[model samples]
Target: MALGLKIVLTFCLSFSTLFPKPIVCLDPGHGTKNARHGCVDEAKVVLAVALELKEQLKQNGFEVVLTHNRLGQDLKAKNPDQDNQKRAQIANRAKAFLFLRIHTDSPSGVSAIYYPQTHPNRPLAQESQKAACLIWRQIKTVLPKTLPQGGVLPESRTKIGAQNGDLLVGSKYSRVPVVTIELVPMSKIGRDWIFQKKNQRLLAQKITQGICDYLYSQH
Candidate 1:
């Protein structure tokens, strides 16, 4: 009996060592109360994609959490800024290994990924960029022909004077590596593709694959 128990313990330890679980926090950009643009509801689309991504990540052995689960439910905050801060707080509280914000741009024609360019937390900023690059590579692989001109860009890479000096509110406050993925723009073609249920699922799968790759690389 003692010998059998020792063998069981050894096997369990080996299994854990081979497959470490990491927590991932996914934030779907907007809620119903937030801004809306173009034909499809941006909030709904992102949420749908996030939910799908969550499932895919789980299947890949990641523990996933979402900032918000329902439509029209903004973080319990007074304004958009506060709302974003609360979102970051959720991820920070989770101690997530990675945080991804999913959003879409208007007047669509491009897809982009972004990381904080100016944050007080230097380590977090660097990790965020690394995460962004990994995810961007996956996205580019999946949507080679659709990527925008500049591809993955830092927040500060915008036109000099026009830059938003601070990091995105959620990213600035996050304690974990963070990246925001702006899906193809709302251009006619973008709308046509993104609005399709099948394409959204495919996008989620590709994003999840990239995330899994990044996490595994860290190990």
Candidate 2:
């Protein structure tokens, strides 16, 4: 490399390392490998929301990363457990402000937000709940009118985490605050206005509002 080029490259790397940008890692729930057939799958809808969220977050001045960057990501996958762990690892590697997973199918028939019941690091657990509450409030505003409101909850209290004593695989492996937002029951998802472009945009904006609140309030 030319002398001047090397100097510029070195300075850029140092700047990135010394004053790292705040990153938010988004996992767009399950993908094709686990997708439900004949319905608008959770993977497809969540990816759309995440893509919209990524743009909104960037406009608010935060760097964004995705665990499943695209729909094709799960095409060759065989192990769901390994996939979930890798999703958490992506957030850890990014050193994100938080790890937020987006999903549309909620068997519970309510809009719910879940945080780790007992993260190994006490502060992480607290931060996770705080963020979940902030996001949950915003999410409620955009939910279907008929959908019941499920308050921010500890993972252990929910049936979704039954396999792991109330802890989801992603939260179990995460090094930072992890939150999973389940939008609505899959049944409502198909008939509702959720997939409408206008509705999706509004939902993205509300979610962005919550994330910004949690991330910037501290500073």
Candidate 3:
């Protein structure tokens, strides 16, 4: 009996070791109250993106979670300056394979943000950089109309960096790989442009495909 119990315990442990959990967290930047480009709100747009990302990731066999739901709560208690502590929590808890914070660019262009390796971030930072590059490349390919600003960058050079905010907040606080993808310029798009429901779905699909490609490449 004792031998059988030992064998059973060992088998369970070995099985767990062989199959590490897969976790992905999504954070939609800003809130519904925050206005973007006078037409659409950051809260609404980002939430849409996050939902789409969750569904797509599910289809690809990932255990996904969202840091912030539609409800409002303090996202930045530990790090008051950056409203991304919620993102950090998700990263810390799940040891997430990827924690993607979705936001929209301003000034009529598209860009992505991640903490550079030269900064406090190191090897984990490199993963984020790679993910950002993959996402940017895929976005550029799918949406030729959107401008390809660049890859993981210092805050100073980025639109988020130029402004006084925590664009790099999640990366700074995150323990696992993290990346922020700026889909498009909400303010730059005119009413005549691609704000239709079909276009939104297309953009979401492109972004989802980009992130999934990055995740698969890692395996």
Best by lDDT: 2
Query: Candidate 1, TM-score vs. the true structure?
Result: 0.83
For candidate 3, the per-residue lDDT at 171 reads 64
Per-residue lDDT tens digits for candidate 1, residues 1-219, read 245334433443354457666788999887834423323577888888999888877765678889888888746677776787888998999999998999877663468888886777888888888888877776676553654545778876533213446577777678888888888777776767777888898888778766755664565
TM-score of 3: 0.73
lDDT of 1 at 64: 89
Instruction: Provide the overall lDDT of each model, using Cα atoms, as 2-decimal numbers.
Output: 0.74, 0.76, 0.61
Q: Against the hidden true structure, what lDDT does model 3 obtain? A: 0.61
Better of 1 and 2 by lDDT: 2
lDDT of 1: 0.74
Better of 2 and 3 by lDDT: 2
Query: Which stretches of candidate 3 lie above 4 Å from their native place?
Result: 1-21, 32-40, 71-82, 113-115, 144-154, 159-167, 188-194
Error of 1 at 150 (Å): 3.4
TM-score of each: 0.83, 0.83, 0.73
